[model samples]
Target chain A: MRVTVNGDPRDVPADCTVATVVAEAGVAPDERGVAVAVDGDVVPRSRWAATPLNPEARVEVLRATAGG
Target chain B: MLDPRPDDLVIAGVPLTSRLLLGSGGFTRLDRFERALEASGSELVTVALRRVEQAPGGLYDAIERGGARVLPNTAGCYTAREAVQTARLAREAFGTDWLKLEVIGDRRTLLPDAVELLRAAEELVADGFVVLPYTTDDAVLARRLEDVGCAAVMPLGSPIGSGLGLRNPHAIALLRDAVSVPVILDAGIGTASDAALAMELGCDAVLCATAISRAREPERMATAVRLAVEAGRLARGAGRIPRLDHAQASTSDAGIPDLTPAP
Candidate 1:
């Protein structure tokens, strides 16, 4: 399956989970501030590994950054 | 989740210690962010949620050390859907439902898109988020935001980072009376006096970023803004004198002889 991870296009094997996309985007397993959202729906941290991804899915791995 | 002291800033039942909600933007380094937070004595700080491209160990560490509650903002989102998505991500990343919702209308103006903002606010509020929308200085729209069960309404004094200060003090005052929720001046603050003016105009609090972060002396400027906020709050409580075309003399006619020696 082809998915966009944090705006980066990536080709991962079929049946990829949200955790696979998140970890591939440089987020550590122990990273505290990271969050994943697939197709605009927030994937809870506990469900990342269990959740499956669809073809051409857009996964956003977000975290807190400095802002006004 | 610190309980607010008596007479403190309470929004959506969350009591905040300080009225000056500082923004963690425009700093080149992490130390300055920490120092500015310290100098301002601000108990609340705003941050944005973006793609996690790299490990943000330093930023989180500074925030932890600063001991200020984080208020995640949708600074760059332009649409209701986008802002809502960003808010969801922010809640998960920051672990706070308190959101500074910004739906930018025009890039050059950096003004809030009223239509989009209200739509997003309604959705977010329904989702159990404590919505604090960054809005325009109009009482009419502020009322709508309040009607949607927003925790607070943040009306911008001017464009984001414009440093123009409160462009319309009368409208801001009107907004303060219009909304029961807290009124926080969100942007366009140039210096300490600007922040003071915000409070004097009846704002419940002020959220400033470039004014303090981009100053020549960020830390000192932060302290100045803090003091100005306090002074303005006190002055606002003190009734102001009515304006008149002519000046009034402080001394009585009987004291005129004191200066008559020159004749």
Candidate 2:
């Protein structure tokens, strides 16, 4: 299946979960201070394992960065 | 000797002793950022959300270690939808509902789109986020933000990172008077005096980043900003004398000695 991760187009397994896409986007499973959203709706950490990604889904993996 | 403790700045029901809010950006190193954070005495610090191509390492951890509350900002978002989504993601990531909303209208000036900003502010407020919008120095917009349940109205003194200082003190003063919510003077602060002037104009607080983080001596500049905020707050409470068109004599004619030449 094709999905847009952090605005970048990529291919992933058809049955991939939110957690799988998160890890595929370079976010370690033990990484702290990261959040994921699918099509603009936040996916809580507890639900990442069960939330399945739809084809052409937009996944945004955001983390804290130094800013003013 | 005015006391700011009696009038603590309360944002979204969180009472804070220090009215100076710092931005955790532009620091060359973590240690320097920590030093500046300590010296500034700010209770809230702003951070941004971005893609994690590379790990942030200890950056966010360092900010947490400083003991100030984290305020995530949507700095790069240009549209209302993007800003709203960013705020939601920030809330989930940071575990805080506080957001510094910034919806840029243009790239060159990095100015907020007033129409989009208002739309985002309204939406975020309805979603239960404590929105503190970075807006222009306009009284009407400040009122509108307050009306929409924003926790505070942060008006810029000038363009972001321009270091222009408060270009329109009167306009800021008007904003201060027009809104009941806390008036935080955000952006375009270059030095200690600029921060002081903001407080002197009756602003509830002052927020800055480049002024301290990009300084030659960030820690020293941080301390300067701390003192300036306190002094300005006290000055405002102390009630300054009204300006006059003509000078007034300090000495009395009756007390003057008759040593002048005879007329």
Whole-model lDDT per candidate = 0.88, 0.91
For model 2, the local distance difference test gives 0.91
User: How good is model 2 by TM-score?
Assistant: 0.93
Q: Give the per-residue lDDT of model 2 (tens digit) for A1-68.
A: 99999889988889999999888877778766788999889999889999999999999888887787
**What are the runs in model 1 whose C-alpha is more than 4 Å off?**
B1-4, B54-57, B255-263
Interface RMSD of 1: 1.9
Scanning candidate 2 chain B in windows of ten residues, the lowest lDDT window is B53-62
Q: RMSD to the native, candidate 1? A: 2.2
| Docking quality tier of model 1 | medium
> For residues B1-263, what per-residue lDDT tens digits would candidate 1 score against the true structure?
77778769898887877899999878767888899999999988888777777436457557778888888899888999999988888888778899999999988888899999999999999999999999999899999999999999999998899999988989999999998999999999999999999999989999989999999999999999999999899889896788899989877877354544554
Q: Clash pairs of candidate 2?
A: none
> TM-score for all predictions?
0.93, 0.93
